[model samples]
Target: MAPTNLELVTLGHRIRHERVARGWTLDELGAQVGVAGSQLSLIENGKREPKLSLVQAIAHATGLEVTDLLAAEPPNRRAALEIELERAQASPVFRSLGIPPVKVTKGMPDETIESILGLHRELDRREREAIATPEEARRANTELRLRMRERDNYLPEIEKLAEKQLAAAGHVSGALTHRTVSIMAERLGFELLYVNDLPRSARSVTDLENGRIYLPPASIPGGHGLRSMALQAMAHRLLGHQRPTSYADFLQQRLEINYFAACCLIPETNGVAFLQQAKKDRNLAVEDFRDAFGVTHEAAAMRMTNLMTQHLGIRLHFLRVDGSGAISRVYENDDLPLPMDVTGAVDGQIACRKWSARAAFSEQNRTTEHYQYTDTPAGTFWCATQTGTTADGEFSISVGVPFDDARWFRGRETTKRAVSSCPDEACCRRAPSELTSRWEGKAWPSARVHMQMFTPLPRGNFPGVDDSEVYAFLERHA
Candidate 1:
C-alpha cells in the first residue's frame, strides 16, 4: 500500500535533513540521484512520494540506509512542528472551524508557528473531549450490535459460565430463584445487601474490597426480575472488567455483563430444553417463556433471540421501542428493515409508526400481547409486542420473524396486518397531501426536543457514577 500523507511528510523531513547536514543543495543531491532538481525539491517538500528505486538511490548518495530515510519521526524539532501543523490543518476539526490555514514558509518565524499550534492544540483538545458523548457512543453501539447480529447474538462461553455458576449453586431445570441468586453470589465470594440509601445514579454497586454488592430496597418500583441487577454486578467481577478507557470499552463491558446476567437468569441448557419442547408442541409464545422463567417480558423476549437462532434454527429480530416511536433497543439478523441513522444506529431513531412496536402502544387491550403481520418492502413479518410502563414511561418490547418462520410462534393467526414502505418518507413520516395543502404554511407546531440527546455522558472512572457518593454510601453502611 502507498504511504499516507503523514508518512510522506515525515519521510520528506528526513531526506531534507540528510542533504542539509551534508551541506548539499537540492541540485547537487539531484545530480547524484540522476533526478531533476525541481522534482527532488518537490519530494523534500512532502509534495511527492519518491519511487523505491529513487529512495534507494538518494539513500546511497546521502551515505545513509533507506530505513533512515523512512524513519517515523521528523528529523528535527522544526520539522516535527511543521508536520504537526500540516496534520492539524488537514483534519476535519480544523476545517470545520472555517479558519484559513496559515501557509508555512521558510521565512515564517518559529514563534508564530508555536502560537498558531497552541491555538490548534486547544481547539483539538476540546473536539476530542466532546466526541466521547453521543456520536462516538452511536458509532460504538452500532458496531457492537452488528457484531452481535453476525454471531446470531449467542455467546457459548457465557452460556457455559452461567451453567457452571448455577450448578455450583445447586440449581437445575427451573426458574432461577432469588435464593439461588444469593447462593451464586456466595459461591463467587460476595454477599448481597439491600439498602434504601443507595445512590440514585447507580442501579447497583459492588464493594470489591469488602466482597459485598449493594442493591436498592426490595419495595422499589418495577421490581419483578430485579435479580438480574445483582447478577449483572457479579458479572463484572466474573468477567474481570476494568474501568473503561473509551466509549467502545464502556459499551462492550455493558454488553458482556448484560449477556452474562441473561445467561444466568435463563440458563442455556434448561432454557433451550424448554424452548425446544414449546417448538415441538407448536406453541411458542413470549409470555409462556416469561412465565416459565419468571422474568420480565423484555428479558424473555431477548433470551428467545439468543436461543432461537442458535438452537431452534429460526432467525428473528427484537425491538424495545418507546411510546414516541423512538427505538431504544433493537436486534435483527433476519433483514427486518429497521430504521437507522447515518451511523447505522437504530437507537433514538423513530420506528415506522406502521410497525407493531409503535402500533402496540395504541392497543386497547395492552394486558395481552399485541400481534401483527407487517408487510414491509423486505418481507412480511409476524411480531408479538408487549407494552409496559416504567419510570422512563411507556415502552413496547417486540420479537418478530419472517412470514415463513411465523408458524413456529403462537401469534401466527392474528388478522391484524400493516404494510410499511419505510424508510420511504411517504410511508409514515410525510403528511397527507390534502393536509399539507390545507395547513402547510398556517401550522406552526412547537417541537419538543429531547434533552437527553443533547446531554453529555457522565465523566469519571465509571460512566454516570459519582465516585464520592458511592464511597460515602459504602462508608455509612460499613
Candidate 2:
C-alpha cells in the first residue's frame, strides 16, 4: 500500500523540525522551494501533501537527498498507520462515501488516500463523542473471545520453546523450590536477594550490571510467587526480550514470558502426566496440584487449562474474579457461551452473581474451594473456585469444564447449580416472578433492588502498572 496519511504527517513533522532547527520562517522555506508561503505552511503541517517537485526542492534546500527525507518509516509506526488505515476502510461510513476502497499502495495517489483518511478522522471523532453503553462493551468482549476461540487458546510455539528451555535446564519431575530458583539464578551469574523494604510496585528487579536480582519479602516464598517472578526475569534474560515498541508486541511478549514461567514451574511432560493420572483417578483438584507443585492456585489453574485443552484433549475454561464480583481474568477453550462486551471477555465487567466465580465470594468458609454446576445457553459446566486474599485485595480463581468432563474432577457431585442466560435481561439480573410476588412492595421503603456495578481498572499486561517506569528500569539495567 502507498504510505498512509500518518506517514505523511510524520514526514511533515520531520520537515518542520528541520526547518525550525535551521531558524527559517515558512516564507523563507517557501522562497527556497519556489512555493507560496501559505501552501508551504499547509505542507509542513500535513494539511496538504507536497508535489514530488516540491519535495525535491525542499530536500535540496535542506541539503538532504529526497531518499533521506523520505526514509522508510519505523516498523512500529508503519504498523500503527496500517491498522488505522484498515479500520478506516472497514468503516461503514467510509464505504457509504462511495469512494472505491483502494489499498494505500504506490499505485494510489497520496492525495486521494489522504482525503479518504481525512473523512475517516471525521467519523472517528463522531464515534469518540458517542457515549458507549454496557451492551456495546459486552459486544466488544464477545468479539475478542471469538478470536481466542479461533486459536483454541493454544500456543504451540510457546509450548515448544518452554519444552526446549525445560530440557536445557536439565529440569526433572519435581516441585520447584526456592533453593532451586536461587540456584538457577546463580548459574546465570545472578545473586538472588530478598529485601523487606522493596517497594510494592517493584515485584522484582534484576540489576544487570551488578548481576543481582532484588525481590520483596512476600515474593520470597520458596514456591509460586518467587519462582514465577524469578522465571519471568530469567525469560527477560534468556529469551532476549527487548523493549517492545508497540502495545501489541508488549502484550505478546508478556504472554510468552508468563507461559515460559509456568512451564518452568510445571514442566510440560510432567504436568501432562500428573493431569492424566488425576483424570483417571477422577480426583483432579487445583489446590492439591498447587500444593504438590508448590505453585499458587492461579498458576496451577492456568497450567491445568493448558493441559486439558492443549494436551489432555479435554476442553476447559477458567475465570477469576475479585471480591466485588468484577471479572479479573477469564478464558475458555470450550463451547460454553461467556458474557462478552465489544472488546471480548473483559476484565472488570461484573459477572452474573449466580456464576460460581461470583458466588465463591459469598462462601462462609473461604478456606476451601467452592464448586458449582451452571446451566448456560452454551451448555452445563462444572466449575471449582477458590477465593484468596492477596496484597491488593480478595480475589477468586475458578476452572471449569463441560458437564461431560465433570467426572474427571473430585467436586463433581456438588448439588450447587444455577441456570444462567446472561447478557439477557430476563436472566439472573431479574428476580423470579414467585420471589418478586412475595417481596414486592411489602418490606422495603423503596421496593426496588438496584445492583451497583463498578467498572474496574482495565486488565492486561500490568493492568495498573506504570509501563514507562518498567521500561526505564530495564533500560537502566541494560
Candidate 3:
C-alpha cells in the first residue's frame, strides 16, 4: 500500500534532520542534487511529493543510500503525538481552554518520546476498537440469539441452581418480597441499602469492600421493578462469573444472570405447574400470569415465552418495541422470517406499520392489551401486545406464535385480522396512490423527526457508571 499522509510527513522531518546534522544549506544541497533550492525546500517541508530520481539525487548528496532514505520506518515513535499537538495548538479550542500545547525539540530521543506516548496510543486503540457501528452491534446480538436458539433459549442448569438457592433459604414458592431479598443478601454477607440519594443514571451499586449494596429509589420505583433489580444484584453475588472479555460474552452472562433472577421471582416448579394447568385449560395469558406472580406484564410475557418454549414444547416469538416503532428486543423459536437488516433485529429499525406490534402503539388506551391475527411471508401468526408508559415515553411488548400454536393462548378467539407482506418494497410500507393524491396538496402533516439514533451505551457491573462515563473516567486516569 502507498504511504499515508502522516508517513510522508515523518519522512520529510527525517530528511530535514539529516540535512541539518550535515550542516548543508538548502542552496548547497540543491547544487549537489541538481534540483532548484525552492523545490528542495518544498520536499523537506512535506509540501511537495518528490519523484524517485529527485529522491535518489538528494540521497547521494546527503551521503545516504537511496533505499535508506526511502525506508518504511517512521522518523520517531511520537510522530502521531507531534502531529496532533501541532493541529491542536493551531485550533481555537486550545486557546479557549487556556492550555497551550507543549513544545519539544525534534531531536528528543525516540525511546523517551515512545514511553510518554505509549499510553496515549493504547487508549486511542481501545477507543477505536470499541466504537461499534450499528451493523457490528447487531451482529453481536444476533450471535447471542443464535446461541439461545441452539439450546431453545432454555438454561435448565441455571434454573436448577436458582431452585437450590431458594430451597436452602427455606423460601418456598410465593411472591418475592423485600424480606426475601434481604435474606438472600444477608446470606451472601452483603448489606442492602435503599435510599433516594443515588444518581438518576444509577439503578444499583455494590461495594464489595464495605459490604454494602446501594439501590436508588428514584430509578427502581417500586413493585416488580424493585424486586428484579434486587434479585439481579443477588445473582451477581451468588453466581461466580469471570470478568467478561468481550461484548458478546458480557451480553451472554447478563442474559444468564437475568434468567437466574427471573427464576427467583417466579419459582420454576410452581411456574411450570401453573403453565401446565393454563395450557390444559387453553387460557394461557400473560396478564393473568402477571397478576398471579406479582410481576410486570413484560416480565410475565418474557417468562411465559421461556417456559413455553423450554418446558411446554411450544415454539414462540417475543418482541419489545419503543414508541417510535423500533424493535428493541426479539426472540423467536419458530419459522417466522423476522424483519432484519444485514445484522439482525435490533433497536432503530422501524417495524412494518401493518404488523400488530407496531399497531399496538396507536391504541387509545395504552394500558389495555391488544391482539391481532396476521399473515406474513413466513406464515400466519397470532400476537398479543400491550403498551406501557416509561420515562422516555411508551414501549410495547408482544408475544406471538404460529397460527397452529395459537390454540393454547387466551386471545385465540380474536377475529381482528391483517395481512403483512412485510420487508417487501411493494407491500404495506408504500402509501396508496389515490389517498396520497387526495392529501398531497390539501394537508401537510409534519413528518416525524428523530432527535438521535440508538447507540449501545456502555454499562458497568456497577449501576453508578453508564456507557460514555466509563470512557470519560478512563481518559482522566490515562
In candidate 3, stretches whose alpha carbon ends up further than 4 angstroms from where it belongs are 1-134, 218-222, 364-367, 438-448, 454-478
Q: Candidate 2 — which residues are off by over 4 angstroms? A: 1-148, 197-200, 220-222, 432-478
Q: Estimate each model's TM-score.
A: 0.73, 0.63, 0.69
What lDDT, from 0 to 1, does candidate 1 have?
A: 0.89
Instruction: Name the better of 1 and 3 by TM-score.
Output: 1
lDDT for each residue of candidate 1 in 6-71, tens digit (9 for 90 to 100): 999999889989998999999999999999899998998889989999999999998888898998
Model 1: per-residue Cα lDDT at residue 18: 93
- What CA RMSD would you report for each candidate? 7.8, 10.1, 11.4
**What's model 3's overall lDDT?**
0.74
Query: In candidate 1, which residue ranges exceed 4 Å CA deviation?
Result: 1-131, 219-225
**Candidate 3, 415: how far from true, in Å?**
1.4
Pairs that collide in candidate 3 are 458-467
Q: Give the better candidate number (1 or 2) by lDDT.
A: 1
Which of the numbered candidates is closest to the native, going by highest lDDT?
Answer: 1
Question: Model 3, 288-312: lDDT tens per residue?
Answer: 8888878888888888767887789
lDDT of each: 0.89, 0.74, 0.74
